[model samples]
Target chain A: MKAFTVEQGIVAPMDRANIDTDMIIPKQFLKSIKRTGFGPNLFDELRYLDVGQPGMDNSKRPLNESFVLNQPRYQGASVLLARENFGCGSSREHAPWALDDYGFRAVIAPSFADIFYNNCFKNGLLPIVLDDAIVDQLFSEVAATEGYQLTVDLSEQVVVTPGEERFAFEVDAFRKHCLLNGLDDIGLTLQEADKIKNYEQQRKAVTPWLFADV
Target chain B: MGKTLYDKLWDAHVVDTRDDGTSLLYIDRQLLHEVTSPQAFEGLRIAGRKPWRIAANLATPDHNVPTSAAERTQGINGIADPVSKIQVQTLDDNCNEFGVMQFAMGDQRQGIVHVVGPEQGATLPGMTVVCGDSHTATHGAFAALAHGIGTSEVEHVLATQCLLQRKMKNMLVQVNGKVGPGITGKDIVLHVIGVIGTAGGNGCAIEFAGEAIRDLSMEGRMSVCNMAIEAGARVGLVAVDEKTIDYLKDRPFAPKAEQWQQAVDYWRTLVSDADAQFDKVVEINASDIEPQVSWGTSPEMVVPVSGKVPALAQAKSDVQRKDWQRAYEYMGLAPEQSIESIQLDRVFIGSCTNSRIEDIRAAAAVAKGRKVASSVKQAMVVPGSGLVKAQAEAEGLHEVLLEAGFEWREPGCSMCLAMNADRLGAGEHCASTSNRNFEGRQGFGGRTHLVSPAMAAAAAIAGHFVDVRTMVEEA
Candidate 1:
């Protein structure tokens, strides 16, 4: 987990609505346990012309030039700008894992599927929810300007555009603390271990069958 | 004020609650499958943490299992795809190392995690169940506080035996009136989703009640609750009743005779109080539900099988019109086209939604004396589980489906997500019994039409979407 104060990077526009998790990483690429390698296969079905399998050399595969991420202008983009209902379908955390692995630090959408939004916070990925109009403005700005960049400051809860315009965003205070300190969910939950152990002890007495493992 | 079902279930599972609105909810059962658990277990290994209670976890491979008798018998060793083979092998290894009880390959207990959980009586009323898969909502039909968790939360639950969750608001989807004989729970649910749209149930825990829902079987109840996620609801449930208790009586993991009486006594109190307040409420008439067929990529793009597609001009808003236009382009169909005129390249009659014995019997009843049409390129039946397949074969359901030109394969979630070998070709159209109709769900460039098992079987013979009501069993 990397503590985040601010990130200044290029933005890539994904001009599609209702982009599902299947479109983000697809089902075939969900097999690997090692999360780092998924970067090359993010949106494999939509990114590559040829079919992708595990262990296949991605450099050998032909890239789909028509894909927005594959276009030369959006190279090394760290901010993903998109439309509404992004990351719908399957509760696979692999979707966020793929996005984070793909070097995306923040995803700005009007709305997002509930599970995907929660998964992002726990995986060191920031999913910023902005108004549809603001998202539209960001998309057009990124598309119209080459090498467009935005400065996202988590502590101040604002996004700074190239023209020094500031747009404020709301984030849960607890989540903000975790992100600022680079604390993963497990690391945060383990702080209250005694309480968890006591609860388990009491639960064993009431629901004996649950613990009997019969 | 009286308590709602959501309040009751949430209160019972609270291990602790923080000032910041997080509750450490105790999880009674954790269901695992190949696709999601491997990475969670890997996270545990890297963190040097051991699972809190191995006995409470149940694991099996379903997402990538081969659905063929030859492959099923040979087990994981016979899996050909390198990625799929590793996913299955990792689950086997993790289960072994963690000492978690798992129904291994060739075991009759092995099946889709959701289907196997209830059948084995591992899911009891008023319990808390969580799984890495979204369809885990299916367990909520038993009056449990069930919902899907991500892989990170999966690791957290594995290590702590609890989850930090915020309570969701309560909603009631009450259906009144009597359903016709041909209307199954699947029809009722699809109709409800059409009325509500995909995001209508978001961030809410819904309770399906009223006279019509109470009359459904335990299996039917599961089917109705199974697709709550499709409506974007994380949790959906029905109150426990005689039907629920009767279904749990003799199962292997259910309580013994004296304990059964005690269990039923507790379950009887799991319903919402008469004066309980719900944050949101939706009402429907059961008799109004028709056999449904989806014409587009999303589950909400549905209409009665007898109805034609709506014209783009009929769309209520510009956004809706744009979505419909995209669907029409992807599906290669025109507005106002009769659904029956659409041709099909394949028919898939199995998924977690409709792969149970009753669902299989319903399809068999339709395909008893019919042969698939020549225009249909392929038709297949993959049972939900090894136990389901065995029971279907014993009742001669397989013979009926096979004689009707359907290929009867082994049990697993084959083609539901096209993660394995069984998938649709480019631009291919299929009538599927699966819950989702997301674009590229079955395969890349494949078009899926959501249907009931009987409707899927009938479509295989007719080579298009035809009302199953007209193709009733011959007297």
Candidate 2:
């Protein structure tokens, strides 16, 4: 995985709130646990009127021309600007996988659900929490200027606008370090292998019954 | 130096602290299910490593497991979906290969792993429980510090008995006064979510306490804690009480007599002091809560059953307005329609959230003599566990349900999710007692309105989503 400091990316604003994980990637696409293939199918239900069928008429498909994702200006967008309470509902990690796979390097929102926010950092996606006014400003700027690009510097923890309107956001130092290094919870745990091994030895001696095979 | 239940549990499980201040917390029990475990099991096989503590870990095939026993008995080849069959079979094979105990398809112990763990005493008080399921916080009713982990973290826990972790900030949520009649644990959680909003509890471990919480039964407490994730809390807990002790006694994995007494003594000390400190605190009067039902897609968008759907223009914030519009469009609900007047196509009363024996008994009490309305498509009663199902059947609750025209099904995650054949057809709406009400949560284009089991039963009889209080009063 290539880790970038997120220098600059176009912000495609999605004005809807409570945009759930299922909407990000529906249940039918959840058949495969492999994280890579899900990006293309993200929002398949909303994008296509009839999914998973051959020779289906696309002429009658409900084309949501107003949707930020479907707009030609936001095509190949790397930064997603969403409203508050984004990524609610299920804790499926596929939501972040789809976001990352769709080439979104960072997500700027007023708030995010606890599980989805945590899942984002682990999957090499940055979820930045900004003030409501700041979020509104970002949305307005994106609406006014097509394909607006904002630079996010992980080293400085600041999001800089096109006009150099920079706002600093706070993230846990450890989590920031993990995201910078592309280390997940498991990768971090594996770094302490010696300590884990020693604990296992001591625990085995104390509770021998637990070590026995069925 | 008074210790909250969280403090005692965290202290007991701390194996060591590294130089960076991260604790190597030893997990006493590791629970696994079908969805998150397959990838972790694959990681283990690729690395050629067995479970570090095989006896301490347990696996169950839920989530993707077919609730219908007949379908399950027909084997993997008999299933319509090849992927679900593969997922279940992989879990079965992994458990056998690793010599870990598994509650498989036909096993009586099989259920939602979160439900099965506590009911069987595999989740003990003061133990650090880790599961590859987000609702693992359901085990916190027993005073266990249970939390969910990711797939890679599951692999780490299997190879090493410890998990690398950062500590959460503490928050005390005190629900005071007595709960009014007709309100259940599901209502309490929904009301709490509404008060706190979805993101209010972020970065904190919430302790549900005070008189109202203390009065709840073990199952009721589990239901309350189960939805903590819905409110953005990392962990939700309740102190061990007599109800907890009583529930744990005689279970297969519980401590023996002498050890049990000692364990209870330790549990008694797990309560917070009168002046215990918390980083954040929220107080709610239980009496103020009503029969809450979700009007919008998110849990936090719920209101009292007597309330009407909210208009987007009346929403307090722009985001709220947009969310209201989106939810309204997807749910096919009018902003001014009375929530109680909305007709229901189906009623699903099961899942880890509200599928306990008490939940069934509560629902059956409402459906005893009443007949389900003909307009209702299907009203199904699925117990959380086979043990619960058997117990309910012995009490003639199943007969009462069938007599009332509700389909009785075997235990699994039936209809709470669209997985399996138990699903609502296109454009169908349901009165579900499950935790989430997101669009297509039940099936593609299937609308869900979360309510209490009693409320669900009443809806089944009335053939529309209505308050159970009215039914109780009429009876």
| Model 2 lDDT tens row, B426-446 | 678898988888777788788
In each prediction, how many residue pairs overlap at the backbone (N, C-alpha, C within less than 3 A)?
Answer: 0, 0
Query: What pairs collide in candidate 2?
Result: none
Local accuracy of candidate 2 as per-residue lDDT tens digits, A140-197 = 8999998789999997999999999999998777667777876645545666778766
True contacts kept of each: 0.48, 0.27
Give the alpha carbon lDDT tens digit for every residue of B1-475 in model 1: 9999889999978888877787888888899998888878998999999898788899989999988777767799889787799899999999999998898788888998888999899898988999998888899889988889899889889988889788888999999988887788888899999999777787789899988899888878888898888887889999988899888889888877677787788889999999999999999999898889999877888998998888988876655788889889888888999999889999998888888888899899999989999999989998888889999999999999999899999888898898879999878999999988877789888899998888898899899999898889341
- Candidate 2 off by > 4 Å: A51-65, A184-188, A197-214, B16-22, B47-50
lDDT of each: 0.87, 0.81
- Check candidate 1 and list the clashing pairs: none
Worst 10 residues of 1 chain A by lDDT: A205-214
TM-score of 1: 0.97
TM-score for the first chain of model 2?
0.85
